[model samples]
Target: MEHKIQPLLNYISKYIVLSKKDEAVLMSKLIYRKYLKGQYIAQQGDVCKYECFVISGCTKMFFADEEGQEHIVMFSIEDWWTADMGSFITQTPADYNVQCIENTELVLFSYDVIEELYTEIPQLERFFRKIIEKAFVASQKRIVRSFSLSAKDRYLYFRNQYPKIEQRIPQYMIASYLGITKEFLSKIKGQLIIDQ
Candidate 1:
């Protein structure tokens, strides 16, 4: 359990310096857990109480439309942090679901605990602020790409961005993330191969 936190500590150190006491406090608050593939870490309509840091494996954050179609919002892997931000901060129900795509290990922090940490270690607040800023920027870019790029172009971009992930998950999930049909993604991939 102590060793499991090294990845998270290393990630945080890249952004902010932590004193030994701060590191101890942070580690004490972390709850380590495991989830099997297809298990939900969070679900729509539930209050998102924990902000999770992935130690291993993959998870997807998604939401279903009224028509019951799931739209992939984001994918999180090793060293990535994930939570339904609005719900986690506001203490309200989540509009999205986060589920493991493979057996996963995570270090989780509850909302109150994180708030306490922020007060105890001001640097942690700065670190999380930077994390959210990057997340926002990536969200904006994704929105722009959806409007400006063709499906095939978007697929190519996604492949470039997450090459390892592309090989790990099902193609249908990738198509959903790209906002395209599985058949369409298959066709695009086939055409790209032929063109090459």
Candidate 2:
């Protein structure tokens, strides 16, 4: 059981020094969960209380408009974290829904438990802050791509940034993330195939 947590501890260790005892304590508060494909891990209007780290498979965060069309915010793969930052930090309802795109495994740490851990293991505070900085950079990049790049350029950028995502997610979902219609994406893909 503790061994199952080593990967998560190893992930944190890159940013902070966790003593054996601290690792044990931190692992004790972590909860492992599995979700089948198409399962909702968190929904719009629900408060996101858990900060989840993906262990395997893929998940996406999206929000629906008044027409009920989903616009994908981002995708989370193995070793990546997923949460509605606004909801998680503010303890308010989320504007996005997070769902598994495939059978997924994740480790969830509650906000309260993480706060306690930060207090007990001060080094974790800096570690988590770095995580926030990475999230900010990603968000900034997404915004810049959306505003300054064409859909094809954005698609290519996304593919370059997450080289493995094309193999993992459905084309329709990727199209949604790129803010382009499925047909357009198909055309782009066809062109790529020709170029290759």
How far residue 155's Cα lies from its native spot in candidate 1, in Å, is 0.4
TM-scores of the candidates are: 0.98, 0.96
TM-score of 2: 0.96
Which stretches of candidate 1 lie above 4 Å from their native place?
Answer: none
| Local distance difference test, each candidate | 0.93, 0.89
- Alpha-carbon error at 59 in model 2, in Å? 0.3
Looking at model 1, report the run of 10 residues with the lowest lDDT sum: 1-10
Considering only N, C-alpha and C atoms within 3 Å, which residue pairs clash in candidate 2?
Answer: none
Which portions of model 2 miss their true places by more than 4 Å?
Answer: none
User: Which candidate number has the best TM-score?
Assistant: 1
